[model samples]
Target: MILEAVVLQVKKGMEAEYEKAFRGASKIISSMNGYISHELQRCMEVEGKYLLLVQWETLEDHTVGFRQSTEYQEWKKRLHHFYDPFPTVEHFEKVYTLES
Candidate 1:
């Protein structure tokens, strides 16, 4: 699977709004092709930082299929304004894992 990792640095006091927007945005992404799962994590040391991990079948499914779709526009509109500075998103592939 392909993993898209998005690190969000929200503006101070915007964390709740960011999470609310993300919950709505997640629904849009979930409907897209090749979507497998999503997980949202918060940084303990940094109060306004979050990590969004999304699993997909392929990179194209995100870069092309989802980003080019109208849903992405809405997603951007809903969530983009909450960031203090735009987040950096990167992709990765599973290399190794240890089961719990």
Candidate 2:
């Protein structure tokens, strides 16, 4: 499995609108191939910062499958404008876990 992470900095005063848009756009990603789960975490210290985490079966599932699909166009249309400087998304693999 792989994890996709992005630090989103929403444009000033658009936080509420961004969240609303994200909720509506979530379906687009959740339905993609190899999608496991995802979460959008708001930063406590920062007024317009958020962390988006998505789990996929493989990196290509996101980089190729999702990003290249037409659904991505919809996703971008729904959420991209809310961002200030566009977020840089990164991928990761679990190095260790302490789950019980």
Candidate 3:
């Protein structure tokens, strides 16, 4: 599995709007090919910050397939404006799991 992690720094006063938009946007991503599951986490230490952790079957499924798809365009439209500065997204592979 490939893990895609996105840390969003939302503009002040945009948290509610961002959450609503993200709820809508999540559906688009969840329907895509190779999409496994995802979680959206709000930061308690810092307001207006969120962490998105998504799982895909492979890196190509997210980097190439999803980003190149029309759904991603919709995703961008729904959620991009809420960011103060664009968030940096990174991908990872499961090296070790303690819970398993």
Candidate 4:
């Protein structure tokens, strides 16, 4: 599995709007090919900061499949504007996991 991680710095006073827009945008992503799951986490210590983590079956599914498709345009339209500086996306593969 591939983990796509991004730190989103939402613009000031836009958290509520961003969340609402993200709710609608979530559907777009979940329907895409290779989409496993995703989670959006809010930072308590820092206002307007969010961590977005998405799991894909493969890296290409996100870098090429999703980003190249028309659906991504809609994703961008719905959510990109709220970022002050465009967020940088990074991908990773699991190394280890510990669970009780």
Best by TM-score: 4
Residue by residue across 1-100, what tens digits does model 1's lDDT show? 9999999999999899889888978899999999999999999999999999999999999999999999999999999998878988899999999999
* Decoy 2 TM-score against native: 0.98
Model 2 Cα lDDT, one tens digit per residue, 1-100: 9999999999999999999999999999999999999999999999999999999999999999999999999999999999889999999999999988
From the highest TM-score down, the ranking of the candidates is: 4, 2, 3, 1
Worst 10 residues of 1 by lDDT: 17-26
Q: Score candidate 2 by lDDT.
A: 0.97
Which pairs clash in model 3? none
Predict model 4's lDDT versus the native: 0.98
CA lDDT of each prediction against the hidden true structure: 0.93, 0.97, 0.94, 0.98
List the candidates' TM-scores in order.
Answer: 0.94, 0.98, 0.96, 0.98
Candidate 1, residue 22: the lDDT equals 89
Ranked candidates (lDDT, high to low): 4, 2, 3, 1
Per-residue lDDT of 1-100 in model 4, one digit per residue for the tens? 9999999999999999999999999999999999999999999999999999999999999999999999999999999999989999999999999999
**For candidate 3, lDDT tens digit of each residue in 61-93?**
999999999999999989999997899999999
